[model samples]
Target: MTGLLPDNDLLVQFSQLFQQRTSLSNMQAHWQQYHWKETIKLGFSNHKHEDWKYTSLDRLLQYRFNYAQKLKISKQQCDCLALPLDSHRLVFLNGRFIASLSDNIYESYQVSSLVEQKNIPVAVHAEVFLHLTESLAQESLLIRLAAGKKSNKPLYLLHISSGQTDNQNKNIINSSYYRHHLLIEENAKIQVIEHFVSLNNQSHFTCARLTISLGDNAQLTHYKLAFENQHSYHFSHNDLILGNHAYAHSDSFLLGANLTRHHTSAQLNGKGSYISINSLLLPFREEICDSRTYLEHNKGHCHSQQLHKTIVYNNGKAVFDGILKVAPHAVRTDGKITNNNLLLSKQAEVNTKPRLEIYTDDVKCSHGATVGYIDIEQVSYLRSRGISKTKAKQMIIFAFAAELTESLKNKIIHQQVVTRITKRLKRIDI
Candidate 1:
């Protein structure tokens, strides 16, 4: 109540509630203490801060939301949120893991529920809201892959949020605050796909954080898919750390939520490590979405690349901020960052910035951003090819996104992403 978002009485109240619940939650004692202190120190985000200037969480503070203590739904409802058949899956409802609805694996991997464990791994966190998320989450999802092995099948995680299913808790609005931790041993390779969805039209808020650690010579592929309802709010953060010779690739598709914000931070901790961050953000109607990323070259021979593309239609808005930093000792580093935007309506708006901070003169870094309308010549060419004007425009926009999608290594997931994106484009009337 004494910090940034104190002006909103609802958020202030929720902060107090979360503070009081920390003692009752199952999180480890040491982490609880750390989170409590941090939450008290870093209260809420405001529009005045440069990092939060383009987005506002003030209006969302107008509504009150509660934590999910008990579930009141059937198995069939949970099944609606799973992935394709026979896939390794984990499901969470309102931030609590559901084992019965999950697939018990027999692979050379380990899956442990943090709520039932005694120790939690170190997290990759940089923002203030992260403290609040840790203070409220009852338990986290922990996944570990064995060393020197390649996963035969990709893993899927489904997070379902339905506001207050039981009538007895009708006055308590439902919200989820969860964290996920992933660890890959040396010479291991894994792929993870995460889906966030809302089961009902009720207004809910989902705040989550993920931390990934890759050992030497490890590789990881991560995909984030957001398809929440317009009545819901979504906030997420992913922190990745790679060791020597490790590789990481992250893909994000932001297509829903009334108000959404995503933060991705990757740290190249050892020499010869690399990472690539790619995202496609499409917002229609009155939705507002923000994507922020930071890549740190901590050691020599490290590389980072970012490609962020967004399409804003109707009165919707999008924001992108990308930063690349090279340490003094991180010589021979290579980095490139670019942000491209397509605006369909005069009412649509975008704010994009690509920043580079280098402490070493032996690094190569470049950054740029572009915002433009659909190319008329390209549209004309498509139209001449027997395509309608609207269809041609849609095709151009889709092609822009395909640059990122076509690079996906998983053929099934690539097709699914394309299909879902096409459906959303059609709903916007091309």
Candidate 2:
């Protein structure tokens, strides 16, 4: 596999399919020969690549890469960041599911493996993204949620990555690249809380794709918290489809990793559908964070909103790109997006871009972006109140983060997110 990217296994096999060298009828045969169960390969970058151009992951893979095989986890260990959730718990160690570390029972949802299902059709609307992962990922994890079910309890997902490498006696060390495929059925309502944390100081990378399909009148609430070591890299892609009158809300908190990128896409395919996305990222110590969001109004009477806040300090960098596209026939569509960045140091950097593409004249669409440092007047007023400069700065940072965290519908998850924000604020030397 020298000269062939370790992350290119799926793409390599997919190349054969695209070239007609391998037939769909013979896919099982190829799967047996070139199939990697849990490990994956990344692609080489060219000028034509749209996604990786800004992220620049091509240079990072050349470094010694290590993949984590199945690792053990104890319930008592790494308890400081844990959140109390009553729903099913799914735990992963180095991108592999660790059954011993997960809670098997749940009152609201049933969890099963993708391999266990005999037949499952790929949704037509999600075909493009599915093809991307199928050509890139080595293995996939599937989550199937039943219809018309509502959960007050939150589904907890804990992802633990350790910097262990599988030598495999090869010149290049084995590093695990992870991908996941999530599907929520029609008319289902649920709350999912995902936490990604690094166990040891090992450089690693993660790429994930999630697709959700909402039935008429369905609803969903999603909360994500990511904390990685300063040496690791992270990439994630989210795709959501809304049915007629369906609703979904997503709130995210990002705190760690040297480099992290998030790509989110939501499509309003049915009339009267709605979605709201709120996110906050706090970066320090030279860490870099970037996020791109796409909201498409394919049907009339659909609405969407996006709001993102970022805080950068100590030479760290943050990037935000928000795009809203209204189709020709999607009249009366309403969409608004805003991206705001708060710079805390003279050396810190931020890039904000908000774009709107409208094909319909009757639609209401607006977008805005801003990047600025804290107001000196506000700081002086706080200092005059007998508060030290450091404490005042910390208070201002905490208040900025609380804006996004306050939207969490679940009380317990809201508190957990606040705790993470507080920890990030305390890490700042200012």
Candidate 3:
């Protein structure tokens, strides 16, 4: 692929595959075709791109991945990967919804297939990956919560990537695309968790997008958990729109994938809207994780807070880019962003950039970043207390992650996250 230009081979392969999928209606096909052209025009981001400078796509683009025509996964396999919590579950294998593996829809909320819906929303951003998913996704889900309603349990969206092997018994890279939309009306409240996992150790690629809208006085708690195999590549985009007095809290855990990129954008369009985003990224053994967030305060009295932490080990790398913008009329806005990184290995690296652009007065905004290693004094103290050096370092690392994982209100989810963190830390040599 040329610099900043679309990969012609990949685009041609995608076009051929898109043409073979007969699920889309005539109108839907036409709609998707328009996006396909836009995707080509926009092309993929290169290392020169400011937003992608710290994360390189060269390794991801080198492979030619095929779409999985069929997927085989058992209920037992899915159950093994599911969180131990009471939730309304929807399962997808290779981007296709698996009704047999999903829970029945309850009366408290409305759920429908995107292909069956007459009105399809436009893409929130014009990026290549976002548009590519919009153009090629064969299946999607739309969920709506009515006014004055509240969900008794969280909604769980599970995605599994299962790639096939060639005749030589060698694994062939596979690709999957999926889109989801959620709407919460006035006075509504709900929690959602989007979880991604791999059914096998084969290399694969997954692209997903979720769009959410919150009406006046609505509340939403969102979580994204990625646990794909270490050989996989993953990308996700989230768009959120908030009305007056709306509130949203988002937490993300990046624990897998050889190369992973997550981007989130929130528009505070109504007065008194509030949003908080917290993320914990653990990249070890040559893994790379990139995270970006954009918050726009369009109305007065809007508030936003972001905290991102990364633990890098064994030549792993992490990136964090955050931007907070306050419009001219957005008075009394409050925004804060902070990123902290802990490197356990001399070869490990982190790049963090936090920015604020405020056009109005009476707004309080701040941005900062810190990159450091384990405190030698603390480690010495623990060693003097008869603690092993490795155990002391592990304790400090766990404490750094616990500061954010402890914020999870659900006991089951919190414990599960902690368990994963512990498991990963055990693999560290330190």
TM-score of each: 0.92, 0.83, 0.95
Query: RMSD, each candidate, Å?
Result: 2.7, 5.4, 2.0
Error of 3 at 284 (Å): 1.3
Q: Write the per-residue lDDT of candidate 1 for residues 88-125, one digit (tens) a residue.
A: 88888888788888778737669876553343445554
Cα miss at 114, model 2 (Å)? 2.3
TM-score, candidate 2, is 0.83
For residues 1-430, could you state the per-residue lDDT of candidate 3 as single tens digits? 2457354456665677677654557776776787788877866767777776878877865666677766767899889988866899989899888889899875577888765445444444446777788777887778899999999999999898875556354435788987898988999999999999888888889999898999999999999998888888998888888999999999999888999998888899899999998899999988999988888899999889999999999889999988899999999999999999999989999999999988999989999999999999999999999999999998899888877998899887788788888888887798
Tens digit of lDDT per residue, candidate 2, span 1-430?
A: 2333345543444344333322223453344233222222333433245544444444454454434456666787645446676657777776566677777676656665444222333332332223343434444467766777776667777777777444453333223434454556677887777788887776776555566667778888888787777777776767777889889998777778878877777888889999998788877877878887888899999989899999999888788878899989999998999898899989998878789999988888888988888887878999999999888887787777777876676787778777777777777787
Candidates 1 and 2 compared: the better one by TM-score is 1
Candidate 2 residue pairs in clash (backbone atoms < 3 Å) = 6-41, 7-41, 7-42, 8-41, 66-174, 66-175, 67-174, 67-175, 67-176
Candidate whose lDDT is highest? 3
Error of 1 at 382 (Å): 2.2
Number of residue pairs clashing in candidate 2, backbone atoms closer than 3 angstroms, sequence gap of 3 or more or interchain: 9
Write the candidate numbers in order of decreasing lDDT: 3, 1, 2
